[model samples]
Structures are given as C-alpha cells and as structure tokens.
Target: MTKTVAHIEKVLEVANSTSAAALSRLAASWRRSAERHGLDPGEHRGPRRLEGTHLCERLGAFEKLMTVAAPRLDNLYSLVGQSGCAVLLTDDDGVVLDQRISAADTAVFEAWGLCVGADWSERHEGTNGIGTCLAEQRRVIIHRDEHFYARNTAMSCIDAPIYGAEGQIMAALDVSSARADQTEAFNRLIGAQVAQTARAIEEANFRAAFEKARIVVAESDDAEAATLLAVDDHDLIIGATREARRVFGFDPLGALAPRPANDVLGRADGPTGFEKAERAAVIRALTRAGGNVSEAARQLGIGRATLYRRMKRLGLDQT
Candidate 1:
C-alpha cells in the first residue's frame, strides 16, 4: 500500500484501541468544530459506524466553513510551529471538495487552485488528497517527501475519511504544512482532527438539506428529480441549471448554496422590469462589450465607477 493508505489503516487501528471516553476527550474539539460547518452539535454522538470494517472500506468548504474548523483544531498542528496550510475536505469519491489555506501562504498550493474540486483517484492525479484515504478508510499523514506526486512531494498532508449513518464514505478531512518534524506528532493530531471535521460536515449537510422540510440540495444523478423537487420552491431555490451557476458565478451543482432568497432580496420577486429597464440597459451594453466595464461605460456614456456602482445596486452577477 502507498504511504497515505498505510497511514489511514494505522490510524484506524490505533483509534479503535482507545476507549469511548478517551476518544471523546480526544475529539472534543472535533464536536465543537462541526457546528461551524453548519452541523448541529447535538447531532454528533461519536464514531458510530467505525467498526465491523474488516470486510469493507470507503471515504470523503469554505472560508466561512473553515473559520469554524480552525479554532477548534488549531492547537493540533501549530502547537510547536506554524503550518503553511491548514484544513482540507474531499467528497465521498475522494474529490478535493474544498480547502482553507492561509491567504498569505496560498501561493504554495494555488499553483492551479490545487485543493478545489480536484479528484484524488489513484487513476486520476495520484495517491494524494484523499485518494489514499479512500483506499484505506482511516487517518493518514503523508508528510513532506513522502508524497508520490513530484510537485506535491515538498508538502506534508494529514488525511482521514469520515462516514455516515449508513456507513457510506462521506468525506475526507486533512491538515497540511510544509514543515516536517522528526516526531510527526502534529500530523497525528491534525489528521485525526480533520477526520472529525469531515464527520461534522456530513452531519451538517444531512441536517440542513436532507432533514429540512422545504430546502433541498440538487444532486447530479437526475435533473428530473431536482426539477420535481423544486416545483413550488422556485422562490426559495434558483434552480439546478448551468445557467443559474454561470449567471451567479457560483460553482454549479453545489451543496453549500450561495446566499438565499431572503439574503438577496427583501421579497422574492425582484422589481418586475428592473432587469430589462435600467439594469437591463446597462447589462446589455456591458454584455455587448463582453463584460468590458470601460468599454461598456463609454457605450453607455457613463464613468467606470458609475458603471460599477450600478452593477452593485442591481446585484448583477457579473459587471
């Protein structure tokens, strides 16, 4: 097995050996941190589906989301020294779901937004991100020089997969930094914390989208199902089409939806003629010029700042 996978198996093995009280004390920060990712603290009981795994295997946002995980687990990694990057999460299939890195140190990972939506299948990129976690189903840390990707070899990452009630692989959580210590204690702490963070997100998504009486997150399996679910909820949802994502600059088919209707407008229906009237005229000229604010300003006989002000007032997705 690769280093990442081997790490996961070992973490699980050791975690299983701990008592329930001990584990809870160990993961206390995890429970509190999940609430930040939009999960209810009352929901997380413990690692319920973590056993009976000899036969089976599996695994799995935001700056707003990261703020929650950071304070809870900060002491885990940065105890001795600072890390270049912090937490990461991946979906059930080992796709790099979302990341939170220090803005000052972001360039190290942003070679091409390396931690956002990148898949971690051994077949795709290599044994990185949660690819090896999906392979091993536990917490693992592939520190600097242990990574298989030549470019990623300089980085150290600790990863763990979280599971749901049905024992399905929900997500993966990770913490990373460029620094390496001979002890690797920080990796162990941060990797375990990341796994707890994923567990929290899974629980949050379940409570928010799945249990909600009205709201529904549209999954990609069937467009028809989303269409059917969104019948009377039109005012609440923006619909699950590429047009909606592109119109708003939102990543398409996302679970952590952007601002809700109440956030965008006092009332659901915008001014009936607003888009086609003043805003429409501005947008038309802007679109004609291919979103060139300066050109659109000249076409509309307005200053660049004036054009920008109008877009914000109208809440146009793109200027």
Candidate 2:
C-alpha cells in the first residue's frame, strides 16, 4: 500500500510539473495525459457505460469486424483467462465491443468496469492499457499503480492495437489481471502474446473483408510477421495489412485503396492493359506448379510456347 501511494505521488509530481524530460518517454507521456485530462490522483473515476440505442448503434458499426474477430478472441481468452485475467476487445474509439471473462472472474472484473459498452478511451479513463495503447499506437503494459487513475491501481494490463486491412487501428485487444505484484517480464510476455493474437485477428478480418480478392501474403524469415495484401480483379491493391504497409513501404494514411498493385509491388514494367490480370493468373499457376513452365502452361489450358510468350510479355521470362 505504501509503495502504491509512492508510485502515485511520483506520477502526480510528473503530471503537475511543466518542465520536460522529468520522466522517461512512456512515464512522461502518461503524466502529460493525466494533466491534459485534468485527472486527480485522489479520484478513481468509474467507467462510462453506454446503453440502449447509443450502445446498439456503436456496436452495430463493428458488426462485420466483430464477426471475424470474436471466435479468435475467444481462443485467446481461453489461452490466458486461467490466470484470473479478462480479455477485452475495444473498437477504434476505445469502447469495449466484446469481452471474455470466466464466471469466476466476472464479478471481480466488473468491479474494475471492464464489461462490454464500457468506455476506456484516454480522454475518459486517463492512462490505461487499452486507451494508452491506442493513444500511443503501440503495444503497452500498464501494470497496477502505473495506471494514471488511482482506481485502476489494482489492475495489471497489457494491450496491443489491432489494425484493419487499410492499415489503421481497427480495435485494441487487452488482457488485464486483478492480481498484484506481477513482474515486468511477466507483463511483457503477456504483451507479446496479445500482440501475436491481435495480428491473427487482423489477418482473419482482412481475409473476410476481401474474400474474393487476390490475397497475397508476404512473409519475412520471422514467419510470424507475415503481411497480407488484397488485390482486386482490376489488379488494384484494395487492402493492405499494417505489416504489409510497414514492410512494403506503402502509405498507411493514403486514399481508400484501389491503388495499382504493380506500382505498389515494384512491377511497373511487368504487365499492361487487359493482360495484367492474365499475367497474375499465369504467375499464380506457375507458383503453384513450383516454377515448372510446362505444368503451369498445362494448368492454364495453354500450350507451353504460349505461356512462354505471355511470361516474356510480362517480363517474367527474363527473371
């Protein structure tokens, strides 16, 4: 209890101070946020819960994404809930859209206001796992007294942002424990696991959103860091994952897609006109055939020579 009070006092000192660099980047960030929101160290604000039509409307907006993510999130919950943690999925605006809590922990988590429809945005709840992760646009661990509000001092949480196909934050996944005194390494491990789970949820959502589009998954040696890009029939890049944008050098905040895939994928001189789609199909067939030209041609119902010519036209033969 004394340690908790001391941590709060330190955070308050940082928050009240105007001098920069008094705290490290993350600590200073939380302090500044508390100052901006006028949060009092002595006060423990209750979560703002949306109800009725407002709650329904907010949840309705995320129906498609929720459908894609709910099952995967449930799997994640099962993986971590044994530790007395509650898994929460919050929409882009920081409203809890879905949750998974064991019956044994439900009452305890409800006391911390982690139920669906609860608002955990930084502006509303001060610096918390979900809100701060979204605010920083990164994964984070807000453990116990590290939270900006005194009310949240008993909670230990790790959060990771879930990005949409358009490379923007679609939601946040958080696993928070009611247990106290968790080591930093333990918290970091939970953060890493949550990040991986969030990536899987994002990939699943991307596939569902572009079910008919040509989805290309680019994977690095790390394997777990694969990137997904969806290209339409017109050979336009319709969607890209956050990893795709970061790894492939595409603008995340660009227009609502339909960008030419060839230009984005470094294939400006590869194909043109009506042949672009055909070239893609041939390449896919060749890849499926393990680069056996004859087999690829046969699969496309075309002669070997015709396939060679098409590949030449698309600049694939030289490569």
* Per-residue lDDT of model 1, residues 1-319, tens digit only: 7755554443333334435325653232222222222322222121112213311222212343334334434443354234555566665666554556667666766553345555554334344545566666666677654443344555676776654322345566766675544336766766555655554554444333333322223323322111111111223433323322333344544442534534433435654221334566777788899988999878866677877866776777563
Candidate 2, 212-238: lDDT as tens digits: 776666644444453777766555777
lDDT of candidates 1 onward, in order? 0.48, 0.79
lDDT of 2 at 85: 84
Give the clash count for each candidate.
Answer: 3, 0
TM-score of each: 0.40, 0.80
Candidate 2 segments whose C-alpha is farther than 4 A from its true place:
1-5, 18-23, 219-226, 254-257, 267-319
